[model samples]
Target: MSLDSTLHEALTALNQGRYKTVLKVAKSGMKRYKSHPAFPNFAGIALSSQGKHRDAAGYFKKALGLDPTFHDARRNLAQALILLQQSDTALTLLNRLLEGAPKDPDGWYLKGQALLNCGQPRAAADAATRSLELNTRQPRALNLRGVARNMLGDEAEAIADFQTALTLNPNDVEALVNISLPLARQTRHAEALEAAERAVHLAPTHLNARLRLAMQLLESGDQDGARDQFQTILGQAPGHAQAIEQLAALNAAAANADLEPIARRALKTAPRQSSDAARLHFALARMARQAGEQEKFASHLTQANGALAHIMPFDSDGDSQQFESLRTRFNAGADQVQAPAPSGPTPIYVLGLPRSGTTLTETLLGAHPNVCPLGERAVPGVLLAPFLENDIAFDTAACAQFVARDQERLPALPDGIRFYIDKMPENYRLIGALLTAYPHARIVHMCRDPRDVALSMWQAHFSGKALSYTYDLAAMAHRFNLYAGLMAHWHSVFPGQILDVQYEDLVTDVDGQSRRLADHIGLKWVEDMAHPERSTGPVLTLSANQVRQPVHSRSVGSWKPYETMLTPFISGLDPNLWPGVQQG
Candidate 1:
């Protein structure tokens, strides 16, 4: 028999949960074909069975090098790296697989899973969407996409995706488990409870679902149920990280209403040397910032950064090429301004530098009974890219062609909800093409103090090439300036449609800014709009926790803490625009 055949038999046994058989077959295969691709594959299986995960990763890497098309080896390598607590490497490999084989649903699904692990929701959604394109019936791909959407701040759409996945395959444990994640994020205790129970029935050992149920119960102010669930999970898998962390958090939350205190307690008590500290600290800092405790928040943040910074190096493309290409394609002449009528639906884009309150703004507008929030979906830029001619010329025919194509896919909505909000913050770079396509769409560009916005962005890990300037501070300033110039050009091209709102102004005088925002879109001031901070829909963005609280200028001068480190990046930009940096 061929070496691959022997390796396949061993893999089949491993997939069938016969670890002993896997060991036996794998050992024989490894001894006979030590230098072949199947040799490494079998060796990886044998090492993994023996709990030697690092060694298994090495073997899988060798197997992949020997046979680049051995996707199974890459997948196995990624999982093994995860076991070794090397999530960044695993995610990078998964991303490579996704791009190399866009038609492979499994590759996309794996990339989505890795992205979810790393907390980059939009990229995960993009991968999942690609996976769906390849195999619409792929329940796992659909479920993963739903998870990504839910994380990116679209609760209703996420629910729809999960529901669709379940319709396709009734026994999808991950889908059942994830259904409750969005509910918890939205603070829907009752619905989350039902979903949690269903998940447990479908998968008796579904830790994440069980953890979600416990968290929902706790957050709903049900201590007894929360305690029981945590204890039950501990009984099955002692020292389970989720149970320990969530239980501690539950205990802390029960003691104080502010949540920051509880978060601090959890961080102190969490076991040292675990890779989860970064996320925990990130959660704490956001809550603390909300509670108006800058010092404590900064401390937790320092700790979190220390943990994640080691692994989460900015993974975005650093090239200025995509932006240049995009700009060159849609150099629509600025002299002609097409007068827009009150005919088609207005595209109200909530644009800003990422992490500078776009989600908060979207939620604020979405709370208005008249608007539908299409959270962070970069459809406008994605729409215009193909239609624009290569030399900055607008092709009206091509633009019209794409608009018709897109309008067909937009979900049907109820009456009185006329305006649609595309909250893609990075769309600030593409406001020019956006006007050419819609002509009638409203653009709300949200700006914060450059330092604060840059700092907020500095700490955050964005997934797109649009925010590629984020890794270096000077680069960020230059990009921000370019964006400013672009927005200026957009205003010159189509004046009166683009409205600028300083994020600082928005929070400082929310009622006043909101009124102006409402009037710009021609909507009357509604009392419910102010309650956007308390929006109960699943917010699927990094700001998911932040939007649930009232707006504040607490983040202003936020770069003060990192002033020393940011000096270079600050000096690199146009200093006059951002006044926070020390002048020479």
Candidate 2:
């Protein structure tokens, strides 16, 4: 056969998914036409199909060197680069492809995927939108856009996009898997589980689908199911670092000795300063702590946090400036904006630093027949964004606009529900705006010991960039100080409108504190409020595992074990804010 016929045979084999056959034919063609780009490109495609991304990238590079304008080779090379986690290079190549062929929807779609992997979700969304503009029926673009939207904290819109992508191509495993995230975020766990299960069923061997299902199971409190799923993933791909790390975490509380080897292996293979290494180290730290190896625990914790700090560096100065601006704007408008009379079912705002019993309080309240719990919704931030944009002076008009916008976005409350809880911990920063908009809305400010709060924040790994300050001890302390100052300001302005619920007190005196919380929210005391562990709804926060168990005082002074390492955080805190606590 001629060289062209041989290349054609390789392309046919590739299209048929006979990757080995494609490779065999491509190698023969390459020996005959040694300098031809098509043969190398064919081999690259086969290697990529076989999951040898690094090897595929080298072949693709050779193809591009032989033929600079080979668009197919260039696209394949970019894909291999992305698969190798070299999104920066993939992005550069995709940009060149788009520059040469501006109408290429695939190029735009690939660019969107690259941008999303690079942590530029906003840019990814824009790129996905551009791709859809060129090819409206593109399911991949819709799915990519949905992922970007979810990352941007727009779960509702993200769900819509995912649904559209599924409609366009029901077999799209990524869409099926990704739709579960926003569904889970919305507290629709059953639907999320169903979506994840469907994704796994559709593509049983797909690592992402299995991982998504495992995560959903874990979040739904099905630890055994999640463990089985993670174990299966590891069995299929022993070097699956994420699965190994997650298994370590799942078993960390129990100090499962079997996980130690897996954790060590994952840590050994994971890239330095990568999130996977951080997760494995944190898991090892937990296991050590559980086993009472305090010295080893401290060492592992330090190493884990060091890895996280390197990967997700906190911008202390920028964060301080942002917090200062929030304080300045809210303080400036405190006198100018008249508090509106609260009407309708009053919103119960659960405001506090993360891991400070906000989830517990909300879960307890949500168990009541009269209250609905909306777990950590982004509506408050969305409503307040307009007021905070461009240093705009917040006034009565801004307050009214915020209230109107928030009311429109508010989800429908259950029948006979007296109040709904918005349990977004970060809403503490928006207490001034919240009270200004809804004067009658009950505010529950959950406070914990600063040391414990800082320690918990440091130990935990948050999913998004929103809590980057938590990675550093000093930054966490600084953010905590800002929170305390803002809460004090809110107290001065709102007076009796805000209720302070101490986490330590709540856990120690469950019944008494529960009654106080009930009275503050204008609800009659119910036995269910005292037993939040029995709550039916999903606890979506990092406190998911904690709230599922009975309230205990075990976590009250957890920082004591690591006190020596937290000197900077404790010393940096405002002593007055933590009454009775001595500064280091």
TM-score against truth, every candidate? 0.67, 0.90
Cα lDDT over the full model 1: 0.69
Query: Alpha-carbon error at 194 in model 1, in Å?
Result: 6.3
State the lDDT of candidate 2 residue by residue for 331-388, as single tens digits. Answer: 6444647757755678999989988989999988888899988888777786576566
Each candidate's clash count: 4, 0
lDDT of 1 by residue, 374-472 (tens): 666644555555443244445566556656755643545557887988888888777666676677678898877676777776566444344546655
Best prediction by lDDT: 2
Supply candidate 2's per-residue lDDT for 316. Answer: 79
The local distance difference test score of each candidate is: 0.69, 0.84
Q: Give the TM-score of candidate 1.
A: 0.67
In model 1, the runs with Cα more than 4 Å from the true position are 1-16, 24-54, 57-168, 177-197, 207-344, 385-394, 459-472, 531-534, 550-553, 557-562, 579-584
